[model samples]
Target: MKSLILYDSMGGNTALVAETIEKALGARAMATDLVKVDKDLDIDVFDYDLVFIGSPVIDWLPTKPLMDFVKRKMKAYARQGVVKPSSPLLPGKFGVSFGTFAGPHIGEKEALPMTMWLNSFLEHLGYAALDQWLVVGRHHHNKEINLSGRLGNIEDRPNAADLAVVEHKVGGLVDSLSAWCA
Candidate 1:
């Protein structure tokens, strides 16, 4: 099946993960529609096989724009109805949430605050979150950053330790999504 993956990156970390996923899924996946959250074509989410979302952590929470967008989308969906009978693909629609951040360690619970919350929202709304990824940085330097988040996003330039933690998080997320997709 095909899919659409979109993300907002502050230090290029989130974008890196999105592109990697596109590569992993190969030709069946879009491979190119990696739109910045604020600048984009209007999302006709139902037209795709899957729609994946990514963002950056801001103060240990999801970027505000992402929250606003999700709210808008859910409202639109609820007003329009969660699923349409004529569109079977619409019912099984899958979502994935991710983020980039520099933060206090949470040991076994390595996660960006915003992404973690978004994952819960998706589940509570009854949508399946297939892939979740988190990219990290230790400092706030764009020279070390490579992407955008929050619409007006934040970039946490990572220290060596932060980079290592992000790597581990992404690995676990990849496995999580793969299992769910299978």
Candidate 2:
């Protein structure tokens, strides 16, 4: 099955995770498309069987650009009459929402809202929300937060160990999807 890894990163942490996910999908012999969310990004999410959407959690929400992208897509879907009141499931379509958060205040709690928001959008579009991943990332601009945050010393986060976990999860997801499809 084809997959899409779409993400937005401000300090490269989220981008790294997105790349790891793309590599893992390739290792599983899946055709995958990696797209960085940008001002000119234009693509149909329905073209892919599985979509992985990610962003860095900023102020307990996804980065503004990513939110804008989702809004644009929602409007387009509405105009096309593709949005259903009940959001009936579209067979063979699935989505995974992921995010990188420093969580200076409340640990993983800071990232949950962002993940849920993205998943809600996917569900509203009729794609089954398959999973959510929250990866700890460094608050590069704020040394105090990076050193004393709830996660503690996350400056080197989304590091190799974190990426390995992401890869392992991708493999599991692929296996699960295979079984589910069969």
Clashes found in each candidate (C-alpha, N, C closer than 3 A): 9, 0
User: TM-score of predicted model 2?
Assistant: 0.98
Winning model by TM-score: 2
Local accuracy of candidate 1 as per-residue lDDT tens digits, 1-182: 44666666665666666666566555333333566676333675555545667776666666666667667776777787864434333255566786665444441134555676776656645656665666554335543322433222224333345445545554555456557667
Clashes of 1: 9
lDDT string for model 2 (29-91, tens) is: 999999999988899999999999999988878989899999999999999999999999999
Q: Report the alpha-carbon TM-score of model 1 versus the true structure.
A: 0.62
* Winning model by lDDT: 2
How well does model 2 score by local distance difference test? 0.93
Poorest stretch of ten by lDDT in candidate 1: 145-154
Q: What is the C-alpha lDDT of each candidate?
A: 0.57, 0.93
